[model samples]
Target: MDIDNIAAKAAAKIDAVRDARVNAVKTAAASSVELQEAVQLLAAAEQKYAKDYQAALRADWTESDLRGFGLDAPSKKAGGRPKGARTRQSKPANDAASEKELIGTTSENW
Candidate 1:
């Protein structure tokens, strides 16, 4: 019962949970606008949850040099953490405002 093994088990459990939710949503869906919205919401929630789970997995890493989510662990020498990992650290930001605005400052020269 080491950290990596426990993590793998927990991830398997999480995947099961996600799959159940998706299946349930699919079963409940109808050819209606409301049903469509519900399905979209479920998909968005799953996507967000998956991303958070991956981040957590990375944060508490205790496995081999190779890294990633689920059962796949690729490396460069062997394909791990991917080359653009550092660049992926922050969101694209994609803002046109000045840095001050980004930090919630006013152009009032405060």
Candidate 2:
């Protein structure tokens, strides 16, 4: 066979293999909108789940409330109030240990 004939055959096979693999991935992924939906749904669920929890905390906690609550601990709003904004009187205590310890004991808890 001519060199071109041999090379052409090999190239065609390689292209076929590549096309097959691509098709396989596309087919499997396409097989289930539910699967895609489920993955997206999971991502969205996780995102919203975290957001919901944080939102709940934000609803209860206001800005400038990290001091008494401390900075090390997790916070829905404890990142030291948003920048460039004046703090309110109802701000969180800047004392982490003290603020965290005050949980469930403050008049607000009642």
Candidate 3:
């Protein structure tokens, strides 16, 4: 009921909230580190699986043989530019005479 008592209560509430926020942030940071490590492990496992699958194919295993074991062949990914995409061609080097012929003025005049 007194001013000092009221101030102390408010300060206690603020401190409690700040402590909760710090704990939450620390928990989330730890979880994020764990998830990043898990993702790297998953990627390495996927790469190994693909390599083994390719080896099986090279060892005279057919798609159907792999499919019988519930494994499907990985889809082929197309590399490079997509269809109908035009690449920019570099301009040819022009001598001073050619430049003058095209623009009616040479670098010397400029």
Better of 2 and 3 by lDDT: 3
Q: What would the per-residue lDDT of candidate 3 be over residues 32-92, giving only the tens digit for each residue?
A: 9999999999777777777778788989999899999998776532233566988887656
Candidate 2 regions with alpha-carbon error over 4 angstroms: 38-110
lDDT of all predictions, in order shown? 0.62, 0.67, 0.81
Model 1 / residue 56 / CA error / Å: 0.3
Q: Estimate each model's TM-score.
A: 0.29, 0.33, 0.62
Candidate 2 lDDT tens digits, 1-110? 69999999999999999999999998887878768898888776666655555665568764345334642233333233476888666655577567776884786768
Query: Candidate 1: which pairs clash?
Result: 74-79, 74-80, 75-78, 75-79, 75-80, 76-79
Q: By descending lDDT, how would the candidates be arranged?
A: 3, 2, 1
Error of 2 at 27 (Å): 0.8
Per-residue lDDT tens digits for candidate 1, residues 2-109, read 999999999999999999999888766644667788889977766665555456557876444223334333221222357655643553456534564757755465
Candidate 1 TM-score over all chains jointly? 0.29
| Residue ranges of candidate 3 with Cα displaced over 4 Å | 74-110
Best by TM-score: 3
